[model samples]
Target chain A: MSDAKLLRDELRKKYLEFGLEAMSDEEVVRLVLSLSCNEFDSFTEKLIEGFGSLKSIEDADPQALVRYSDIGERSAVLFRMVSEISRCLAVKNVKKGVYLRTTADAKSFFAPLFTDHREERLAVVCLSSRLKAVAPASVIAEGAAASVRASCRRITALALDLKADGVIIAHSHPSGKAVPSSGDCASTELLASALSRFGIALIDHIIVAADDCVSLRETDIPLSFRDRECFGYKITKLL
Target chain B: MGKGSIHSGHRDRMRSRFLTLGSGGFSEHEILELLLFYSIPRANTNETAHALIERFGSLENVLAAAPEELMTIKGIKSESAFVIRLMHDLCKRYSATSDVSADLSDDEKLEGFLTEYFSENHGNVCLLLDMTPRGELRSTKCLPTSSLLSGELGSREIAELVVRNGFVRVVIGQCIDGDKCIPDASCYSLTRLFAETLAPLGTELHDHIICCSGKCFSMRKNGSFSFGSGGNHE
Candidate 1:
């Protein structure tokens, strides 16, 4: 066999033996590109150099990927398809009936929902009394890159319709930190109080930003409604 | 109506509601009240439940509270406190026995099991899953830390554990605190090392699952890592 064929065989063998993670980014990219192009080593190097990383290449538009001399429409579309498939599978892997018992659970479930969205979006995960999710997350609102509004009435209606005992409100900060802004805090307080009146617990308000997420409940922001009495009994203040 | 009859009437109604609708139909305080009814008798458990929740901030915290701490509440005597503690213990026992024969080879099943296993666990910790040749989980052992880079638990120690227990198929799990479920370089290296070590001894390293923020990343399913010829035993 020729040198190129030998190298391809070696890469395939390593992948089967040690797995894709054992291979370098360049080797994995080259292996994928090799299926389409004969002369993929130099092309793979150029693509990596141009895109900076495999993740960036995956995130790149098909049109942008086709700008590379060696990459045709077929190759670019292949990259995009793989990325999209991975994302869909990730979202699907979030099984229903999973309990959102803690801030981390809420963050994990909501993080995947906000992936790849450049604009701000608000979603609510309705939970049963046992803290299990009643259904998948519903994107109730979408807005510009910076801000999105969450209507208390709409959220309450959805919760009532689903007969959810609790709700977790989440919104993405596409271009900003995961820290809740003043507006976010105020809106969360209002939403929490509004839901409380309906006897639906506000489990958490998560702010998802890229790969990071923060819970408003875990932060220093005090929620007054959280302290209010329930069942007609005065709450004994804890020291 | 008499005060005692009023209390008895309300208890009867609550009991009926509980039997018809189950615990999921009740609020946190209501559930606690129902549990307190058996121990506290005809007294108003609604007020006691409210007081318990208010003082502890949540029903979970109340149950987790010590018997001495529970007695601080007005109506929570020794019997009621024991009932609360009993509920907590019963939950723990139920979780432990329910999924003992779980098939770890199924990605979804493994993920669900790991999510629950690491729910109460905080910070980063390593877990070793010993499984039968048929992929049924045998037992799980939790390590001190998941930082393989720190040399806290070496591959040799894990290999020994597998050999000593005669576990033919094993899986490794780790719980990280952040939202990123993807394995880092050290994790990759550790998984590779573990697989290589176990492969020689006829032990299969099924998958290395990284549990983070309730999400599970399985190396075998993601095609990120492979071990033992990638054959399906199940």
Candidate 2:
């Protein structure tokens, strides 16, 4: 067998024999570098531990990952590639009408495709009549402030064009602090106000930062009440 | 010249005279006159402040305009303008750097960055930056929020960006309130609606922020309850 295959086989044996749970950090590092695919057990576990969990690792910054002793630029890049692939797959599945049940479930859907990125991103989650996510589209860079007008116009236009029933807005903070910014609060109100006039529903806004993601609805801000809508306006009850 | 004269009034008068003289490239003495505006309340800063304003324009404009704009005036030749410009650019770029990535999936970072940017603006001007999946910066556009009653954010505006530029992700940011406050239900609802519409196109809804004067709030922080759709992302 080739050296890579042989090395992978050897590591797999070690992983099974010692049980991956008991491996040392050094051993995990050595094994990660030797594996054919960087998605080895030790590498993933190391990434998870460093980031606190798979969801966090997926949301971590690439440069932060590179800072790890065993994770060089190459490994960091590879891991990011693997993570991005997973994010794409998750969005793809959701777009295919997959029902998302929990935040963990959402993380799993995106873990393969998005991880360790330096730039910010914005996406629109399109839903059908049943509230199932049917598709997601990137709304492009919203700048340092995640303002509503620009994002809302883009998503609203897209929703109108697609004749979608509803939409969700989600994005990540590379700073790894998922606490909502004031801008986040304002845009949420603006977008919701704008879409209310169109008969389309705005369901939620999600923030994905390092190791933690927060949903606006979970906060004390009254969300479900029509009388409490933003811009001093109420949206058409389309949910 | 009487014994009951203001002890330090002479300094104030001299400073104002210097300010007037400094209007044509104010000397050090003339510039010091304007610095007295805040320090010496009754002090006459007419000559100095006028000179400074002549050299730099109105104080409001001087502070509001870009440092590059400030440097265009005479007698302000120190690296201060460059420093000021650098500081402003750094702030913009720092926020921009927060979302720096070549991969398209990392676009959420960009969205987060912009949300904070726009949430701080009180005006109507909106800033939009487009990118490809390869992390290349694309075209930047400005749109008025009030005028966008009919304009929708469709893929056509970003078609070349996504296809030719290889941008798998995109983010949009702007500021409006100049005071970050909790978003209303409509905000959360609109974001969710957008996510649902864009799902088929393979794009993800990252975030929406309301930027106020000095603060920002992420809808996701409070919008999670409304999202309800839970699944593995990675």
TM-score of chain B of 2: 0.37
Best by TM-score: 1
How does residue A4 of candidate 2 score in lDDT?
54
Tens-digit lDDT string for candidate 1 (B87-123): 5643433343334335565778888888876674443
lDDT per residue, candidate 1, A158-232, as tens digits? Answer: 999999988888898766778878888888778878888888877778898743578777776777645643222
Candidate 2 regions with alpha-carbon error over 4 angstroms: A1-95, A100-114, A137-139, A142-147, A222-239, B1-234
Q: Give the TM-score of candidate 2.
A: 0.30
Fnat, one value per model: 0.00, 0.00
Q: List runs of model 1 lying over 4 Å from the truth.
A: A1-75, A145-149, A210-212, A228-239, B1-234
Scanning candidate 1 chain A in windows of ten residues, the lowest lDDT window is A230-239
